[model samples]
Target: MKIFNTPSNSSTISGFLLLGFPCSRKGQILLFVLFSAVYLLTLMGNGSIICAVRWDQRLHTPMYILLANFSFLEIWYVTSTVPNMLANFLSDNKFISFSGCFLQFYFFFSLGCTECFFLAVMAFDRYLAICRPLRYPTIMTRCLCTNLVINCWVTGFLWFLIPIIITSQMTFCGSKIIDHFLCDPGPLLALTCKKSPVTELAFSTLTLVPIMILFLFIMGSYALVLRAVLRVPSAAGRRKAFSTCGSHLAVVSLFYGSVLVMYASPASEHKAAMQKIVTLFYSVVTPLLNPVIYSLRNKDMKKAMQKILGM
Candidate 1:
């Protein structure tokens, strides 16, 4: 019997070489500096939000609590890729160990999945606060909010565990060179000795299905929210409602828009450079921009951040 359990000819492959960005020595140094600055800024921005949420008594609410948690998630989310990417930029070999690559693949995707669930939960929170304000306090109690947060983390981490394990066990042969910065499923699968169409389909389904469902849920919530806002007698009240939701919608747009494009079709269909840009956008740039979007659009958060900064 042909055994799928054992690798055919890839046993010697100990690691995968991540090609990172195609740039000159000078360009690499410049990119290293640029991404380093961005990484530091992203950490500080998200950290400040968490601090602002924790220290500000006036900001102690479900929304802010969710925001704080999301910020915390973003911190680790970016960490899962940026530091390694920075290291790759400086290193000549640009080699990541076999296990290390898959571990990164797992954590990066798991964290991203968590972020998706968090976004959907945040949207739900907004729906409750805006559509059912009277019962919001009673329904979305501290206990429930905490449970929801826990559920997001648990569900997200668990969601991709089986798929990652299955993918890791497959036989990877020939070239261990991944053309992208990170250990993505597409590049890894492309290196496998045997083509597993079922595995590819599972990965695609896992990546796209949850995102679509969450996006649709967010849209449905906003539709009802829009309906309610228009019925408000006062323009000021409507403006307040829109202002509150605008930040989330902006974040949602930035995240979902890029991810949808990245995963809409097979990654092989996309140019390597384009893949890198899209992945970098959603993974690195989005996290950096999230805190700014929230802090600028949210007056309460702005004030809280200002207080923390002694402004």
Candidate 2:
């Protein structure tokens, strides 16, 4: 119902104000230090995953290879927003240049979309490994894995190109202030002077469908895996099957659980501080928690890590 009323060039690229946290100076400094530490640890965690996958030939299989790529994606994904968020915490201006804002918007969503595709592919990998064990080796070959990885990156980056460009071109009026820390669609859309239903619908549809389809695909993959494990009959077989699939399941649950929480909230009731907190929580899982979960269950991975680290 908000009518946009600005008389500026829509294409001129007026900058954005990121009103992150409205805290005192002391609180801001504390937050900066905390975020920096978390960012460093995230780098270390994700970096370790890539190095481990590359160093250990034993881990050169489709699953670990995908994981390494996912970790690499996380490195860029977290970097897309966290550094800028950290900077905003310190600066009084808190102004992001028009180009920088759009760039951040593009990379943040693109990388996130890539992560979704990667997760779906990983689910498919588990399905092959568990449900179709005999055929998995031949089917999930190195070349196929490489191709899948490439597809995820290309499709994800291209996914929002049209919608994002359109949304960016919309005439944002009034204060030009974004309440949240990142350049999320909801916040960006809210800043528009007039309500553009067509743009909103397009953005929502483009964003929602892929995520929903991939989520459904992941669920089906795990269901098939669970069914296959249940059919094993032998207690030992079932335990082995559960052990093989447990980590992936945990990662999927953690990732999607956070996502659902963040998105399910009504846009009308969106709280800036809360949204920022949820975003931080959601982003933290990728670089900091995912690889840890993936490798935690594998004794073989531990041995490989020790050998790789000369420990």
Candidate 3:
């Protein structure tokens, strides 16, 4: 409730103090080691998926093409925050400059938004392949897929343009101390001197509406796919359909499960430590798991990975 007399522009505020994970020096070092290992694995795992898709001519279809781009997005998405967090672990002061913080904030949200668009597009690809098998080649052409990919990236970055600008212009209160490792929106908003419900709603709408709409669209796409698959008389055909959709469903669960929990409700009710843990679940754990989920359940993916690894 106490308002610090800081300027309304965030740039005027001195560097923010991020009170990252409360732990002893030994514990910090341990976490640093653990996070570092996870970060490296995430990069390598997703990187391998992209490489496999690119090098193997068999994996150049729209499905694998989308997966390759999605994997690349995951790499940068995780990098947008984790590296800075790793540095925070070793730094004594834990200070992040205003520009640096906002830049991370911008890229993190943009990439996440892009991922949502990509997932929905991926689902549509599956639907087209399953529901309209004969015309799929004509409908989902290479040019169309290329356009969809570029649209996802462009629209995501542009989606929050006004809302983020509005958020950044808000004044900060007495505390510039963020308890979490990243420049998460909840924590950033909480730091504002006065809460603007209208701006908050606009921001929340910008964040949640796309997620909800895309989620429903994906569900609908799957529903249609499932219905059509059931109509197929051959057991082998049914199994193949299920196998392809299953991997996507699993990846979706891992992502949206954590996201809806953390962001779909009031931010103030969740404790800072809980926020950190939940964010870490999606941000670090899921990226590492996605490549495994996509590859292990898929035949082409497995072959591609084997070829890439020369195994």
Best by TM-score: 1
Candidate 1, position 283, lDDT:
99
Candidate 3 lDDT by residue in tens digits, 33-136: 99999999999999999999999999889999999999999999999989988988888989887777778888988888898899999999999999999999
User: Which model, 2 or 3, shows the larger TM-score?
Assistant: 3
Candidate 3 wrongly placed segments (more than 4 Å): 1-12
Candidate 1: misplaced stretches above 4 Å? 1-11
Estimate, for each residue in 1-311, the C-alpha lDDT of model 1 and write its tens digit.
Answer: 12234354455577899999979999999999999999999999999999999999988899999999999999999999999999988889898988889899999999999999999999999999999999999999999999999999999999989879888888866787999999998889898888988888987887788889999999999999999999999999999999999999999999999999989877778988999999999999999999999999999999999999899
Q: Whose lDDT is greatest here?
A: 1
Clashes of 3: 0
Candidate 1's clash total is 0
Candidate 3 clash pair list: none
lDDT of candidates 1 onward, in order = 0.92, 0.83, 0.89
* lDDT for 49 (candidate 2): 79
Q: Is candidate 2 or candidate 3 better by lDDT?
A: 3
Q: Between prediction 1 and prediction 3, which has the larger lDDT?
A: 1
What's the best-to-worst order under TM-score?
A: 1, 3, 2
